[model samples]
Target: MIEIKDLHKSYTSGSSKLHVLKGINFNVGQGELVAIMGSSGSGKSTLLNILGILDEADTGSYNLDGVPIKNLNETIASRYRNKFLGFVYQSFNLIGYKSALDNVALPLYYQGIKHSERNDQAMSYLEKVGLASHAHHLPSELSGGQKQRVAIARALASHPKVLLADEPTGALDTKTSYEVMELIQGINDEGKTILIVTHEPDIAAMCKRNVVLKDGLIIDDVMINQQRASSYV
Candidate 1:
């Protein structure tokens, strides 16, 4: 569902330019769960930003689900981003004062959905994420895993074509991380495409495909037998 070809990006600091992505090519199909692994300065974050439309490449092409993802104004970019992408970050990125349901409903609100309808849809997503009982809880009231589940629910509430997770389990303990991965695997099984940017090997093993980047280049890309997260949970 994603296409990238000869992607190159660079940042200028004073007289020197730091090349982040160099002649990179990658593609992801519908219903695939892929893990992107890289160390610091590996260009993984830059790639994710481009994929999420949070940043643009200096040169090359990116097409999301057949539509070109380049040279758009911020307004159009935001619209496409809301329409096609869902994000789950390491920080959870939930509004502190908002309840889980409201946080999930926030995107729908931006889509201009009616208040009643947005809340209904939000609750349904919450139920899907096994957080219905905690719907009224604020982020502060919930545990770390629960907060992440709410964030996932928020991401899915928009019915995004691809889910992009950055360090989804970075803050949680072993058991909680596995539990969250189990939920993610379940979502992938239901035919939603997902891309996870992570540094952990065990977490990468849970995905169907793994792509490794180093020095702004893809050094390894392979499909492997997927490990079910449920076994660990």
Candidate 2:
């Protein structure tokens, strides 16, 4: 559902140019869960930003669901991002003053969804993430895992075609991380394409496929065997 070709991105600092992505090429099919793994300063995050259309590449072609994204103006990019992409950040990025339900409903609010319908949809996503009981709780009151669950719920509330997650399990304990991964796996099973950037091997291993990035290039790609019987056991 997503295709990127010869992607290159660089930043200019004084007389030196720092290249973040160097001719990266990758394609993610619909319903596939994939991980992009790389070390610090390896450009995985840059690639994610470009893929999400938050940042444009210096040179490359990015096509999401057959729509070319490389040349989109800010207005067009924002619309595509909101309408087709869902994002989860390591920081959870939840507004401090908003309740869990409110935060989850924020995206739909921007989409001009009716208040009552959006609230119902938001609550359903929270329930899917096992956070139904905490719907009214504020971010300050929730634990790290709970907050991340809320973030995931918020990402899923829009029912976007692709989910882009950056270090989704970075701040949680092992058990909580597994729980979050399980939630992600559940989403992927339902045919939502998921692309995650993470440094954690275990988390990457949980995905159906992995792509390793280095110096802004793809160095390896592997398909994993899904442990279907043990997925829920």
Top-TM-score structure, candidate number: 1
In model 2, which regions exceed 4 Å deviation?
227-233
Model 1: CA > 4 A from native: none
Candidate 2 — what's its lDDT?
A: 0.90
For every candidate in turn, the CA RMSD to the true structure comes to 0.5, 1.6
Q: How many clashes does each candidate structure show, in the order listed? A: 0, 0
Q: TM-score each candidate.
A: 0.99, 0.96
Can you write out model 2's per-residue Cα lDDT over 1-233, one digit (the tens) per residue? 99988888999999999988889889899999998999989899888888888999988799999999967889998899888999999999999999999999999998999999999999999999999999999999999989999999998888788999999999888877888888888888888999989998888888999899888788999999754423533
Best by lDDT: 1
Task: Give the worst 10-residue stretch by lDDT in candidate 2.
Answer: 224-233
- Flag clash pairs in model 1: none
